[model samples]
Target: MTLSDETPGGAGMHVHRLLDEAFAGVEMGPDQQDLKEEMRGNLVARVTELTATGMAEPAAARRALDELGDVRAILDATESRPGPGEAAWQPPRVRPNPAFAVRTVVLSAVAATGLLVLVLAATVVDVPLAAQIVAVAFVALAAGAITADALRQETTTNHPVPPARAAGYGTATLLATTGLGAAWLYLRDAGLPWLVAGALLVVASAVLFTYLGATQTNRHKAWVLRQQAPYGSDRFTEDPAAAARFGIYTVTVWLVAAAAFVALTLTAGWEWSWLAVVGGFVAMTVLIARMLFAPKA
Candidate 1:
């Protein structure tokens, strides 16, 4: 079924455009033409199904393509014979979206500017505390935006992370950035409140990150997963229960660390409390190594 130009805007158009890009430069033998047609039909159906479920047409088309996973693999499979010295078929590289590239550049510039302002305020310039706070917030938000946008984009060998999960990652990034900023302010002798806020934000980010890691499923497309099969999957994929246990362990570690940090701040000193955070990080690293690298049963 040819995708006619007369077809109205929606999944059909998106699918057609995608198929054009995917099949470009490939010699269209009878078998290849048939395969392309079959793929186009299947992809259109999948996109239509996805769009019916409230997904945007563009996103639906992309998801459908992602599910197909490396169109070149299928094309290679259909080849009955290889001509003499047909150079190794390399998969087409997925280029970064122009719009996304521009967005990243802009956000990076903003983040850098914010950092410059913050350093100047803290060290050389006698900028107002309010202005310094604003600079910190800007940097945090820019970082968060970059993280979220990156997660939401489809990579060469992996599908886009779900929007909700991407947003969670972004939130964690923001919390960590803000926490670092707060810690810096406290080091500048701002106040005990800043110290408390910094510690809490850091702990919160750690918890969120642990949870995300534990719950994350593989997003690699079929071809990517196949290539990785020889290396073997992670223990968490093999035993989900282990992942759950690790998540619990991580949470407990961080909570205890937070409590210790507070107690040390009260009894020893704010200077000594940071040791609690460092200890917690070391504990978590050891836990990861033990869980992920233990001898396979």
Candidate 2:
């Protein structure tokens, strides 16, 4: 049967057709046929699930299409490997050290917590509005610095960056710092100065984390490519749909956090309460879990 026949909806069908057209020239051997079929089947299943969940057919189709990006790369990898008549393709080797991974994760968590604590404390201590603003800005600057360092390490090591890429990690850091400074000048008395400070800190932290996340994502992709290159096609890397999904997910998290913050503001009446603290913790937990456990495209 044609690939389009396997798609669940008009959009998905169109995507299936497009993937087929794009990779039409690719010549597959018996060994590669199973791999191609498996990938295609998986995409189809995912698209179906998305549609069944009440996503607009077009959106589901678009998502499915995006998830199938970089099919050509995958195809090249699949076809270039060592075979009966070809020189054996030696896969690039790079082992991720578990200790390093653990250390990175721990350090990232510690830094995040420290920054949050500093912001919360500033809000609670009834410090000068200017001081509180400065503190918030400092935290943002720190987060941005940390993210930049991480990006540098990833690039130097030839790791791929993640999807939903953001620009100017440095700029985000600087802006956050600047915002804090402004907040200090503007916030005063028993008014909403702390709220302003908290908002600036949260925005800065989000930007920093988002950049870090994208970088790590690219790194993971590089690792996977290295491992899978010798065995199968790399067609999946060409698609932009995965990154789009991640962007949507990020926005969703931000909105949820905003809602929680609003609720806390209304209930706590300007106290340095646990509303955002709890929400941030929960958001981070979910994000980490998804990153670690979600099925790869």
Which candidate should be chosen as best, given TM-score against the real structure? 1
Give the alpha carbon lDDT tens digit for every residue of 1-297 in model 1: 232233235665677677777787788875566566567667878987998899888878878888997878778754634453352332334778999999999999999998998889778898777777888898999999999999999986679999999999999999999999998888777898998999999999999997888788778764434333434578987566788888889989999999999999999998899999999999999999999878887
Tell me, by lDDT, which candidate is best: 1
Give each model a TM-score: 0.53, 0.30
State the lDDT of candidate 2 residue by residue for 1-297, as single tens digits. 123334443543544564565558777675445445445555656767897889866566556757776666766665686574462322334566565466567656655664565556557654454555555555555555555545544432366333234336645665665565455445444357655764776587577757555533334433333334334333324333455455667677877877777787888765744567677778868874675456656
lDDT over C-alpha atoms for residue 257 of model 1: 98
Estimate the lDDT of model 2.
0.55
Assess each prediction's global lDDT (C-alpha) against the native. 0.81, 0.55
